[model samples]
Target: MDKRKKTSQMQERAMKTMPLGVNSNGRYWGKKVTPYFQRGKGAYVWDVDGNQYIDYRLAFGPVILGYAYDEVDEKVISAIRDGVTPGITSQLELEAAEKIVELCPATEKVRLVNGGSDATQHALRVARAYTGKEKIIKFEGGYHGSYDYVLFSTYAPPSTYGNSRSPITVPASSGIPSALGDLIITLPFNNLEILEATLKRCGNEVAAIITEPMLGNFGCADPLPGFMDGVRRLCDEYGIVWILDEVKTGFRIAKGGAQEKYGYQPDITTYAKALGNGYPVAAYGGKAKIMDIVGQGVTQGGTYAGNAVAAAAAKATLEIMSTQNVHGYIDAMGSRLQNGLRAIFKKAGIPCLLSSMPAIFSVSFGIESNLDAREWAKADASIYKKIAARAFEKGILIDEDPREPFCMSYSHTEKDIDDTLEIFDEIVRTL
Candidate 1:
């Protein structure tokens, strides 16, 4: 358990080269842990000090096939040998795009990017151009990514969020200009009344309304019956573009993403995280009319966009996941964990809610097994944190941040879930 050497080396070397010792907050992974990932395979990873742990973070909703998947590694390495950035064109990019469009009907036209924030930012720009409007509408508990526009109202605790009907546009972090709030209007999620009223008030000024179709931010809130239909109808009525931000829910939920799972289509959709099987790549696309703005003058290009490595990785990732049985296998694995955890807590007399889709699952304390956003707002973070800490010490790693949901990946076997549940049961019994 002595992480001194690894943590020290990271502090001395890694921090000097990178800001805050990492590129993303997910890497920080929260709470007294200095992440110096040395290696990962299947469902396990080892820190620099050789401390091994089962990885439930799964790179924050990516790594669907687990870390360093054999097929993905071979594909990416093979592509590198062909040439890192052949620049002009590669069959890999075309293959990835075509597969994405075929899989997710909501994404009629796709454009590659290097990260989620960039994909989201450019999607907004395209929406703005196509609609000739100014404002963007986002939900209270949705997390799109780290862009000025999408940063507002992502898990801004109930204190600052105000009444759910008239939520405040609180930025996720400092350094964001206050003016960004003016461009974003925050709305309560899982409630159609407020969304309808808000759209009626300023639907004219709003160019696009973006949402996490499955609500990945606050432990996954299912859209109530007709909520999605109402939003889609209103968007059509007012000509407001509806965007489903699937950066987290993309490949995790189902093959066709949330749009398919929920039986609705968005004007625009953005994807990242699992798309490249842990490699850094993302994309945004939708109706051809809206995407056309990207080419005209909206400036949606990245030097690393569709680079050889990411493109090849994505192509291979999609092919593997797109298999007829892969989704079924993933759903089975996730369901096993979800049900096992629920049963474990139930038997332990611990009231807990299990929220999950096909490939992802989360646990919250002090909430019923049937979870909702409002109930999730009342969860005991300290309990989950204590549980996560205990699990980590037992070599089962979960997200240390109180805000993050416990995400399950496709690579985790039923045995992993059984062991996780055993440790969890022991931890909760002590609580």
Candidate 2:
């Protein structure tokens, strides 16, 4: 133990009934670390132990405008004062959806949901209903959400997964019924030939081809030239819906998202994370032709879908993102952080490399470089564990899962970047 985590009497007292002494396992920092967030501000987080760290996780991408942003807080507070969950729709919902459609040119219609999972799950349902098919083609590592069909595969390659070319599917978590494995056709990342082949064989049964546009969960893998175009063609050739799971990369990648960045649009796109800052909100819809299915009782509704609080927060977030070059800031910050990490590896005599896409970045502990999910899975996850453990020893919070990409937020300043990089440099040298 680092001798810093002395549990408060309140914490000990609460643990008697609360499972794991906390609500979420993800929020728990480490064995020696229990991340009891006291407060957060401007790319930094404070734990129950009172240790402040420059937070690279960015509250798992929801804090895009940064923690406790004054403007956002004002909006949220205003909503809170008005009432967190109003019985009816707030004007903020209209404003937010309009902003999303405006930013995402492909979006002609939008339906708000609670979170990324809600957006993605509903997107799949809409696709299936629109196209009258049940199957979906999800990449080996691309994670959408906790829904059944999606849960069977999220960042699973190597280990239990066999044969990269025709990769086998594995369950991300236990509760996901094993039968879901059969419904999903898991494809290898960046392999257009195999992807095309798989779709050709089962395109008719497939309702939608859901992808992260840029295989985000697989170390921020950029799409190969014309790769997504090929995907679009296959979908069109078979009347399949091509839904972009931009829950992670949507607003963060660009104002129009990967579609704008890559110059190819999907039939539908899901939005969350950056959509609501830290509030609970998500949306999915595009090509009114397909979205029409949702209206005819194909179904998409939630008690909290357009709840007032989420609507207000999303509206405020969109307004801020639209008014400024938020994408530019994200791009620069990610580049700087990527370069800084690479410099540390070089100076430490470790042949490590960092891969990125503006806001999302990954540090490979073993491999010098890699192209896709299969390659990333082979990199040294154990080495990442070492680095993560050491970083936590100091006051830094990186995403603990090496397979998952770390992010850059607009809130992270030059000083925060410099200090974090310095710590990484020292840690790598010691390793």
Could you give candidate 2's per-residue lDDT for residues 1-431 as a string of tens digits? 44464545435655787766777556554434556677898898887667888888886777887888888878878878877667677787888888888888788999988989889988999998888789988887787886777875574445666776677888887688888888788877677889778876777899998888766666777677788888898888899999988998888878787877777779999989878777778999799888887869887778888887788888888888889878798888778888888777877777676776758877786776566677777787888888988997788988787866787777888888789888888898888
| Stretches of model 1 off by over 4 angstroms after superposition | 1-5, 12-19, 29-32, 369-375
lDDT tens digits, residue span 152-264, model 1: 76756756787776777889888899987899998877677888889889989999988877667677677777888988998999999998888988877777788877778
Task: Name the 10 consecutive residues with the lowest summed lDDT in model 1.
Answer: 367-376
How big is the positional error of residue 187 in model 1, measured in Å on the Cα after superposition? 0.6
Per-candidate clashes come to 1, 0
Error of 2 at 271 (Å): 1.0
Error of 1 at 207 (Å): 0.4
lDDT of 1: 0.80
What is the TM-score (0 to 1) of candidate 2?
Answer: 0.94
Worst 10 residues of 2 by lDDT: 1-10
